[model samples]
Target: MQPSSSPSKFDNMPGDIERRPSVEEALDHEPLEKGWWYKPHVLKLNFLMLAPFVTMAAWGFDISMTNSLQSLEAFNERFDHPSGARLGFYGASTQLGGAFTIFVAPFIIQKLGRRAMCLIGSSIIIGMSIMQTFALNFNMFVAAKLLLGFGSTGVQIAAPVLITELAHPRQRERITAMYNTTIYVGLIAGAWIAFGTQDIPGDRSWQIPTILQVVLPAYQVLTIFLCPESPRWLVAKGQEEKARKILVKYHGGGQETPLVRAEMEAIMAGIEADATRIRFNKTDISALLSHKGNLHRILIATVVAVGSQCTGSGLISAYLPQILDNVGMTSTREKTLINGIINIWTWIIGLGAGYVIPKLSKRSLFLFSTSGMILTFVVWTALSAVYTQQGGYSYGIGVVAMMFIYNAFYGMCWLPLVVAYPLELATTKQRGILFSWMFFCLSMSTFAVNYINPIGLENIGWRYYIITIVFTLLILCLIYFFFVETKGLSLEEVATVFDGRENYDAAVSAVHAVEVKQAGEPEEQHVERKDER
Candidate 1:
């Protein structure tokens, strides 16, 4: 069979012709059991789906290094005891590079497939890690950090989209939650590595951790080729047979089963519906913006992306030691120990939440998380205020406890939802672009928080907690009002929720009509074989 270049076989059909196979007709197939999740092919598919998150962990390793490096004597000796402002710049540079990638990724993702983009991202990360490891000057180090940010953007944008496309519809949430949860594994690894090397007398203390950053990306580059291309991407690229083969292999037990056929039809229908509203061309930004529900999705994506960063996570993660110093923890060893422990706690809680995510609603999770954060910040701010005035060890301890509590809630809710929610909200045709925009929002928020945080800590002290408390409360209200539930829908079905019920029904009908027209001879022959029916 030839690869199709057009969006769909129905392209030559007239604009006024609205015929389609019925939704019922398309859905008429043997009932497939949910136990497909236990099959060997499905298990292998899950592993392949999750492989990219190692890169996410690598990204976390970079972020978590800042906390330990701040207090390490060997690191200070090499970098000349940089000021808080300069260190903040080092952290912000990565985010700045990430923000820059947002504009360029849409084009790259469109031209190259998701797998290729992931490989490119991994290669960039590997090269930057090598550069960062051997940097003789501060500027060289910062330049390497900036490049890591740029490379990470590709990983962040492509990874989730690949998972969404490849995951079983019933299991997407759990799989995505797993992806989000593993990012903390990198953070925990980085923190412990820094803590382990803190007592060393030479540059190797810091250099070793920096060198270790290459491992996960190296693994990604070596193993990513083992995974299949996203079936949705293949179909969108007009390689339906290839897409069908993938679906059968991974999802249909290596045959064109009814379940596989149904899924392909659904994906095709969604693509056709999307193409009708928006040209599939990369230059057609207007088509995306002009769609009825896309703007709302954009708003939700931006708010979720920004809200995840703005909740004071940047301040705490990047400058835990400084925050601890403010709270009377004067020992460097003590501060590093606490930072490592907190990351471990985050990883633990995040892993548990991954299992629980499928059982809870997205809005409920966000509401609970944001609400818990507000309460934690309120108490933490009050405790900090008391500590600032009276200087009690108890108040300082309370502040630290609140930090752990805040991170627990954050890991449980925000971390997993941030990537998964935005992926679900976007149509297949616009998934990459939407993710790019989401990451742009994430990078901007991270940059603002990282750059402003050190200065804020210096100037306002605990009063900065008040800003997060207020913003988090506002985010809670936004979640209650606007965020839609998308717990169990397949990727193609998700489009219907946004496009309105009537339009969805129409789109399904149009898809069915096209399928009937294309299969006219075979369908008629099958019907004749059925005789009495």
Candidate 2:
């Protein structure tokens, strides 16, 4: 179990005859000074990073629109007075499609690359939105829902990986956090659109909002092509020169700077280490399953992914108006207006959280969020129970207020971390597959919650809060015990956290060797080191 100084075994697998240069041999390159963020290339690179968020915003619009659609009289009338149970299935369909998509994503992402996968996914979303707009029956609409889910899963798997790989190490958290926060923008758009259009006569009421879902994805498809493919992905494919060029352009001030060389070496070293441990082929599940440290990663990621959906936020987002109705805000107009306001507030809070994330530790933030959710659910449950028993506006208002508070806390804690943590945890070689698995967990939990929330609301009412309270408490315990701190580490460096402290030290040493080698230092003094193995 001792760490090896040299690359892992998979680095030299049979038929891998292509001779790639070691980090020291690859370049004669200056350390990029601090404040690289102010450079022109970095500024443009930051702007391009927003493409994934645009895709996510479209997905968010669909989700919030579904919640609004359930309350729209025109939609209900046009679709033949569909029951809440059926609406739940409609809500769950996207997740069901997403679950199926994850199994296929690893192959697609490998063969086509991250940019292509996102393009394909965004195209599917555009098509599905059109189909939903013109659907003649509930069945067709359901089919559109399923297809959109499949499409968005592609974007979900690729977007985070793309942004994570493309980002400068110093800004990765802020970039990913901002990506997560964009969902609220879509939610707010969907909410206000639904609110404004709900009074229109005939099918156009729901149709207008459904059709508007195409705008963001259309923008995404147009702009995604302009963004570069992941540099890590490029290296794994043995296009090191291309990867290096991208690093220089975006991260190294258009030169093969020392910072770029160190980063390239760090990435290559991690990939080599991962290759030694796991099969390069996407189909080799056994390799991924048996790889050292991967199981721990999978468990942590699965818990975080599934936990985000099942901890009652899915219930809130998918059925907000219904929950409002349960709490005595029975007017459709009133409910829609309140939902619109809530979406705006959630977006504002989420944007604030994104800005502050780099200052907080992952473990502390997750624990704080889950703790707040538990308390909010307790208060909400109490108010809801009272509202259900004694017909009073005070308890009802309290219930509404608690829901807003719960969303605010959830926005601050869970929303930003879910995407960033998994990307940080998995190494480049396993990132695509890891994201697929994470989304698989997400889709499964989303399916279960979306399907059950309506039924639970009907049968038990306030008692549903009890289920979320228990789940939130359980998540709190899991985060405390299992989640590792990953703040301020490069994605490659984060790999060592699971592998071992010795392995981490080895990675640092490898990067340091490159730094010293570039600085004209004595090889004996700086490069020579023990294998530990």
Candidate 3:
């Protein structure tokens, strides 16, 4: 029952090592299915998962506030009607703040636990929200935005990694799906709040929505303490008993079960064999680049991170109101209303995608989503050209309709899989680097898109969609050629997809042995999260 501080037991299996069933094939399903919803401990774990879900809402609110505020006359007047680069800089500054965190993030992830990062992120954003609400000048407002990016980027970096590590086996895919989608919920809240207060006479029109930005980050702060740190992180830090008890509650549903032991064994084997650990240094980076498998994982991480923004969603996210203006839908109330409606639509589509996510392979979903977007953008861009040249209201309206279609296709897969796919790809040893790099790419691409989008629309009109159209097509080719499917595997088992069949056989064999031999052993702790609640 000692922690797996030593190398994996199966490194030198006697005689010929036998191939073994994967965690997916060996998983005990009957116990997990019986009254799953009604189980109290299980119910509590689900509630705790909400901590990460709300973090994205904080991000969504910022995006919505940016997009909505740009359309507001009062906000424009207050900021002296920023246009071109000044306007672009305002939206892109947050990503600049995010880029600043890239190097230090790995050190923090190594030392502090995941929950600590989440808490720290939420606390930072709360102060920035207040700073933004009462800004004395545009300079003060941009400063708030720069820091808001820093805070929100911290939350974004940790939240999905937390979800991928902490979610129940049955719930991981769907929970991760729902996590990113919460941004749309935050979007809806920000959009409607701004819309609701738009008619007010003065500064309060923008101030109300800006100040209310603290809502979700504050909620994350209050609830994050309820969330357990990642069990995988615990085991790597040599706290196996605490890790075991966490798995027992969330993975085993209270008691020590075969499934829980299998997961723990697999995790230990992964840490031991793959050098997954609590510390990071130059060596981890070397290891990350040393293998073709790890290189492939990094490649996919880049695609997902950059692709999420490049698929034209970034333009809509930062410049939807301008997009509306481009297509001749110029009324402030109508623009904000359309923005609010699109948020609701994307949220609904996001929830629907959750059920479908569990059913499709990751490769299949990425391909389908990208293809759908390519088609939507082609027609969307063409319609915008018509609007620009002919000046027909129907052409403008058609362009608006295409945004809805584009979001639906994007929502089906990219919405959720951006973080989940990249996290799943990285070997545990390289998770921190790949996660940081993924977000770094995301922030930079989003910054580039957000910064360039308004200028492109202003200078070139409808032609801006052409750039994302070309980028998204390249993304689709990458998915078809390079992406690996990780649909049915447990988190530990996912390493085998990158590490090869030899390590796969050893890891799976160890899990089976542990599950059989340790199924009857007494746990050091059990159902403790119940008390946490």
* Winner by TM-score: 3
- Which regions in candidate 1 have their CA more than 4 angstroms from the true location? 1-8, 11-37, 276-283, 513-533
- Evaluate model 2: give its TM-score: 0.90
Candidate 2: misplaced stretches above 4 Å? 1-37, 276-283, 501-533
How many pairs of residues collide in each model? 3, 2, 0
Worst 10 residues of 1 by lDDT: 524-533
1-533 per-residue lDDT for model 3 (tens digits): 11113456555444232323333544544465456677787788888988877888889889899889987788989989988999899989899888776776766765787777778878888899899989988889999999888878887888788788877777787788778888898899999998999999889999999989888888888889789988888876779899999989886778877567557766776665574443345764555466677678778898898999888988888888788888889899889899999889988998799767878888988999899999999999999998888899999889889999999999888887786778887655567667888888889988898888889999998787888888888999998999988887777667777666565555545554454445543333321111100
Clashing pairs in 3: none
The alpha-carbon deviation from the true structure for residue 437 of candidate 3, after best TM-score superposition, in angstroms, is 0.9
lDDT of 2 at 211: 94
Provide TM-scores for the models.
Answer: 0.90, 0.90, 0.91
The better-scoring model by lDDT among 2 and 3 is 2
Tens-place lDDT per residue, model 1, 8-46, is 555454333333222223324434466655678788887
User: Model 2 over residues 1-533: C-alpha lDDT tens digits?
Assistant: 22223354332233212222333333222343566567788888888877776767887898889889988999998888765688789889999989988767877887789888888888999999999999999999999999999999999999889999998766778988878778888888998899899889989999999999888888888898788889998988889889989999998768876567667867866776554333345645565666568888999989988898999899879988778888788888988888888888888888899888988887898888889888999999999998888879999889889979999999997888788888889888678888899999999999999999988998899998898889878888888999999776677668878875554445545544544545666545422222322
lDDT of 3 at 104: 66
Misplaced by over 4 Å in model 3 are 1-22, 25-28, 32-34, 276-284, 507-533
